[model samples]
Target: MNIAELKEDLISYSKTIGIDKIGFTTASTFDGLRNRLVKQQELNYQSGFEEPDIEKRVNPSLLLDRPQSIISIALAYPTKMSKRVTSKKGERRGIFCRASWGEDYHYVLKDRLNKLEAYLQEKVPDVQLKSMVDTGELSDRAVAERAGIGWSGKNCSIITPEFGSYVYLGETITNIPFETDEPMEDRCGSCNKCIDACPTGALVQGGQLDAKRCIAFLTQTKGFLAEEFRVELGNRIYGCDTCQTVCPENKGKDFHFHKEMEPEPEVVKPLLKPILHLSNREFKDKFGSLSGSWRGKKPIQRNAIIALAHFKDETAIEDLTILLTSDPRPVIRGTAAWSLGKIGGDGAKTALQHAIDMEQDEEVRVEITKGLQLIEE
Candidate 1:
């Protein structure tokens, strides 16, 4: 088959594989992405990598050595899959966002892309191919914009007319040259709901984010968190999806199939009490297959304790008390003290006192004091 026929077949196969949109462009079409990377670097908004070079990311030769064509794809994740606002018993209160509500997109896309590559190899006989779903040096949003899959919104996400910014992206770089799609027109226009809805002032004037201040980055980051940012973590233990929630275009759409990648009966709305007691093995058992599990259980478990604090659940005093004295991780003990203080009952105060007496780490002792004050209030 000719390159044009192969391109059409590729798009058809992508749709069959459950991808909502697919578009093709030259690997070199990411010049605008390169510029944005520079701007992000200058402003210090690099998220995944430290000291990222935008110029290299957009340059195909740097990414693929001699790529001729780039295939960009978008998978729709619906807002309807998210839980309703009312906090209730048995209902896991808080947010996992819409995109992460189902199976991990990386595995889903890679399995399908590999099949497509095999099909092309049978027909074309001598094509070189490599695929990436947010894992390669290739710029995903950049190629999606150039390929006409969607326009980039002010929030720095690709916005499709039907799916908005609630989509996952993947790419394929191949030696075969195919006809490229025209770039999509920017449609964000004058909307600012995404900026207005952000609980933290992470969004900038043009919808760019400072990763250092972003809650999405904060909740998943390893190590010590700034005291001021702790309260703003709210109830999110893994990721924050506020920007996408407020997008006018994303309102009332169904995108996910509700397939939890690892099927942890507890993770659908995991209980904060149990999380505080997790051993390293239990942590891996619960979150290993999920995207954020690589950081181990400490960061997420600490966030869970903070979320319990946010809920101010008096019922958690027993669990928090046990964690303060018995939990091996100082971070968990410290966060439990904080949560106990947030709950603010006689029992919570007693737990905080015990944690303080048992605490050896200075930072933990300081957090214990802060928790005691919250109880006093």
Candidate 2:
């Protein structure tokens, strides 16, 4: 089999199948990534969402037998909404990060990977392959970097020159030995924009991230948001984009290359008050297609309460009071109590006074006290 010719043919086929960028690399163990992951674990910097087995994560051979090559692909997603939602006064909205604006990228990227896998199988009938997207054991950024898809940026995203960091990454490990591409040179010299812009200082330094403090990671947690980070969340209901939005490389990098990645402005930036009352069915009906909904509606609803407080919207006082007084979920009730304090008014104060006595949960009671304290302050 002519391997070089096959590589070129595969690259051409990838473009025809909606893959924005594709690159190939040897399936060698990611030595540098293993060390970094160990350090991150020691520092308690990991988000706990990743595969616990570091060996499986960095060693492609563990995932696929006799893995000879790895192929990385990227699909560009839109940064700006093509259609705009008109803003009306007192109708505060919470924003989802650009990554979660459209259909879940896992499905989108997997479809492309499946096509690539089929193409390889057709050419080499005995080809062995294993594929993964974001939830995969191998780091998408690490594979993409080695495969020459893009350079790893300070924000921990693969920043393609053509697509900036606004890209979804996926990879396939194969027995076929394809020619490799050179890694891109780091273009983030002396630029601290992504690090400096991180709301919770999650970017401890240039390329290192303390995931526990990252708003994007924090937004996914089902528990109560850390008090110190609540104010930092702003109106971000799902993930934080401060780092990517501030990057100079992404200034003019909006791309609408795939229709599946287009945002529905109303759904991505929905009214904050309405989110507070969404039934499970309603939440799924509205946001199930987006990647952000994978964690279910609890975190999103809590963030919506925080967003309402960020706006200090007195209009949402009735909704906040309902949640504070009667919500079955302690996290939601406590978060509502805190938000009511942040959005203090006569009505909020009255609700807090009533809930402090009636609330049974120790944590919820504490939040109610905090709410009352804020009103006094």
Candidate 3:
């Protein structure tokens, strides 16, 4: 088959394999994408992920020199999942932003891409084919935009008329040239809802994001969260979706749903007391397969304690007390002390004193004093 026919076959096969959108482009799409990755790394915008290794992540040549074109694939995750919505009451629960609420999309998308690769190898006989699902050096969004599957929104996400930004992107890099798709135009217009809605002011005047200020990054980071940003975290324990939620483009879509991505029913909106009581083992067992779980339990557990502190619920004092003395991670211990203090009362004062006496880490002790004082009046 000619390149045109090959492109049609690839797109058709991709849809049959469960992908929602498919587009084709060349390796040159890296020009703009590579620049973005480098800029983000230079500004320390990557947060927890190691600085994007420019040479490794940016260079398409490293993966395929004779690469004729790229086939970009998009998977629209169900946006109507019940877990995306949280209660507005005092006992608030956190939601895993749509993208992360399911069986790991990376694995799922990659499996489909692998099948496409197998199909192409059999059809093309000797063409080089490599499959990647958001795990590789190429820019899947750039490819998507060029392939006409979507346009990159001002929020820096690929936006499709059907799926918006609640889609996972993957691609197949191969030496077989495919019929090219047209590039999409920017539809953001004068809309600034996404920028204005960002709680941490992560978005700049235009669309640039300061990863350090991004709550998504903050929730994933390990160890002690910066004191200044703690209150800004609100109740987000995993990632933040305020921008997407505020985007007009996402308004009518169903909330993304995938049971594998959700917390258990009881755990979905547990009281602060129950979360503080989760041992390291329990925390691991509860969140092990989650997309956010790769960083281990300490960061999330600490965030949970922070959320408890944020609520300033007096009922959290007993749980915070246990964590102060029994939790293994020093960050968790210190943050728990801070939370207890934030939840101030006679009971919290007593717990804080107990924490101070048992606390071995100077940081924890300092936080205890600071947190206690926040509600001292």
**Candidate that would win on TM-score:** 2
Tens digit per residue, CA lDDT, model 3, 1-377: 78777777777887777777888876653666668777887777766464256655555557886788888888777655453445444455554555665566788787888898888988988989877766676666767888788888878788888878878899888888776788888888999989888887898755588878888888888878887779888777778878887888888876333334443433444444555666668876766556766677677778888887777766667777888888777888889888877778888888887778778888888998887787675
Report the lDDT tens digits of candidate 2 across residue range 318-369. 9999998878999999999999999998999999999988989999999999
The positional error of residue 254 in candidate 3, measured at the CA in angstroms, is 1.5
Work out the TM-score per prediction: 0.91, 0.99, 0.91
Off by over 4 Å in 2: 86-88
Report clash pairs, candidate 1: 78-255
lDDT of each residue in 180-244, candidate 1, tens digit only = 99988887889988888777778885548887888878877776667678888887877788888
Q: Candidate 2: TM-score?
A: 0.99
Residue 330, candidate 2: Cα error in Å is 0.4
The CA lDDT of each predicted structure is 0.74, 0.94, 0.74
Per-residue error (Å), model 2, residue 234: 0.4
